[model samples]
Target: MAAFTDATRVRSDGEGGFEADLDPLWTVGGKPNGGYLLAILARAAVEAAGTQPHPMSASAVYLSPPDPGPAAVTVEVLRAGRSASQVRARLSQKDRTCVEALFTLGTLAAAGDPRWIDSTPPPVAAEADLLPTPSEAPGTGLRIDMLDQFEQRIDWQAVGDPAGELRGWLRLPDGVGWDPVSLLFAADAFPPATFTLGSNGWTPTLELTVYVRALPAPGPLRVRQRARLLTESLVDQVCEIWDADGHVVAQATQLAAYRMAG
Candidate 1:
């Protein structure tokens, strides 16, 4: 099995460009996961800039779904300053744009003193204590296969309930350590929190922005996601990813369009 880093690896294509093979193991349903695609673009941007700045924030807009094959990532440096670099990256397949993103890169201090804060990590059960989802039969579809890429222990008590909240333990398959880049994928790995409110059908993300706060410790990540507001056709989700040591590693907010069953 290819490690997550190797699966999402991007190679230099030439000046100001890079190329990657989108592995099928990262696809959900029939489309590649949005966060996985964003990580590819972010990696390209960081390399093109040559600043070695860690990914601080990224805002991505998913235009279309790219096939699980070779894709081209072209990056343009908007500004490279002493503190940060801003770049625009676009992933195109067969000359058609699939995803576009603006990335902000900056160095993160390993240690810093915070003045005040009110956020706290949510309580969740240990990974071994949670129940595993039932195994799917052969040819069950690519979604199940994609989920298998990560170890997820969901809080079933919150699922299908009317709390508009979801909590769980999530981590990459064993051998893949946590990194800032991978947090991009982790931010969007959970099922839509809107499902708890009796909403069903595909909820496609229109836009997603993730903020990386700190490096993660080596263990399963604690994932907390909830919906703050919902309209007839839209939902706003907020998520926080806490490292094993109970520190916030990343946070994300996304706006998605809710599609009802026909």
Candidate 2:
């Protein structure tokens, strides 16, 4: 029922770059949150591409822990075409890169193909029905409260049992728009184990990536996650995201460097 008070504010830093002030509301484990950085990265891409008749797809990488102050964003116009544009957005602190995003904007005029296809959505417990979510338990792994900000739900089995896979649904903040940009937001919260592993003490995102297939229509969002210990010290999370009708929406793969306990 509450809204995020510290929404990001974008401004020009001259030389064609932008900056977003980091506030307390966008935090994970009491530190700056990944969603905040991702949101700013996507916003930079949209601004650099200018306004389009249609939405866009964006992918980002988290390079380092962001400071608790203002974040400098650099946007580059990689390419421009009649129907699409490519732009790169980088978030930096102290002249070093903290995060980066690559995005594509599509031009549409609302006067083209009008065909439609119906598909089945992933099966989930009814909204009125009950569903399981992650909880805080002693050591073993991390616990998440997805219900706090997003509507998506992750069962305790995914983490408490540490099975090889993760399964759940993702939803937008109660009143957000249902566009490709919304898809970008839905896909942004995953590869959660980066913090899970770090939770043993503290670890920050080293890098994050998300791929887009097809944006889901407005409704409940679903996510299925599975991870493999690629090396003795590295973990790769392979993810599948679906819409409420069980239709596959997107897939993502991310690698996280484990942090030692503090």
User: What lDDT is reached at residue 198 by model 2?
Assistant: 39
- Tens digits of per-residue lDDT, candidate 1, 1-262, equal 4367887789988665899999887867767788899889888989889885678999998888898999999999999888899999999999999999999998865423336557777878778889654224244332444676778788887564438888998877655667888888889888788767767646788899999887788888899989988988999999899888888888999999885544
lDDT tens per residue, model 2, 6-114: 3555688776888888665545554556656766776667777685433455666777777668879898878877777888888888888888877777753322222
Among all windows of 10 consecutive residues in model 2, the one with the lowest summed lDDT is: 108-117
So what's the TM-score on candidate 1? Answer: 0.91
Candidate 2's displacement at residue 256, Å, is 0.7
Residue 224 of model 1 has an lDDT of 90
Q: What TM-score goes with each of the models? A: 0.91, 0.73
lDDT values of the candidates?
A: 0.82, 0.59
